[model samples]
Target: MRKFNLVFYFSGGGQFACEIEAEDMATAGSIAESLELRLSGCKGYDLYVKKEDK
Candidate 1:
């Protein structure tokens, strides 16, 4: 299994991340769902928070 870094984001604020062993990034989706976390979406690596400024 290869090491994939997954990051989960929240609408309110902040993010969560974990490194797991998986065959591919797509397969890791189930792992994220199994955790039962409130997620806007799985975002890129280190983008922890954001909102529309304009």
Candidate 2:
């Protein structure tokens, strides 16, 4: 398993961070997108995942 960091900024000009566990970075991105969709007060957001050396 690997850990990924998702960094994004919402429509209201607020930055947010999310961490997720998955077999790969692609999976982590999917998980982050799902989580983002369910949040309130988020008109839009930039999706991204960062890979770590660990």
Candidate 3:
């Protein structure tokens, strides 16, 4: 399984970012949903995951 970094941004004012190490996109989605917070945008990257493994 592969890991991913999920970044979530909120609409209130500042940024609400979380680095979630998940096996796949589905797991990341579930985790994001559990937050129950209002987010303006979301982005995922594999770069951090690769670097972390190094």
Candidate 4:
């Protein structure tokens, strides 16, 4: 699994961000989308996969 950082932006103001562990980006995006729908005034979200140290 990999670590993903998700940032959700709202139309009404404020933001929601978290770091989650997931198998892949697709799964992370799905989770983020689900959260967005559950929260009111969510405009969209950005997904970032954390880079592992060498």
Q: RMSD in angstroms, all models?
A: 10.3, 2.6, 4.9, 1.4
TM-score of each: 0.49, 0.63, 0.47, 0.84
lDDT of 3: 0.53
lDDT of 4: 0.89
Query: Which of the two, 1 or 2, has more lDDT?
Result: 2
Of 1 and 2, which scores higher on TM-score? 2
Model 3 Cα RMSD, Å?
4.9
Against the unseen true structure, what C-alpha lDDT does each candidate score?
0.54, 0.67, 0.53, 0.89
lDDT of 1: 0.54
Error of 3 at 19 (Å): 0.7
Considering summed lDDT, which 10 consecutive residues are worst modelled in model 2? 42-51
Report the lDDT tens digits of candidate 1 across residue range 12-54.
5668777766565555656656553444454434321222257
List, residue by residue over 4-32, the lDDT tens digit for candidate 2.
Answer: 66666666678777776788767776776
TM-score of 3: 0.47
Q: Which residue pairs in model 1 clash with each other?
A: none
Worst 10 residues of 1 by lDDT: 43-52
Best by lDDT: 4
Model 3 residue 39 lDDT score:
43
Ten contiguous residues with the weakest lDDT in model 3: 42-51
- Candidate 1, 7: how far from true, in Å? 0.6
Q: lDDT per residue, candidate 3, 1-54, as tens digits? A: 556555555444445555666787777677667663444343322223424554
Candidates ranked by TM-score: 4, 2, 1, 3
Give the poorly placed runs of model 1, Cα more than 4 Å off. 36-54
- Order the candidate numbers by lDDT, best to worst: 4, 2, 1, 3
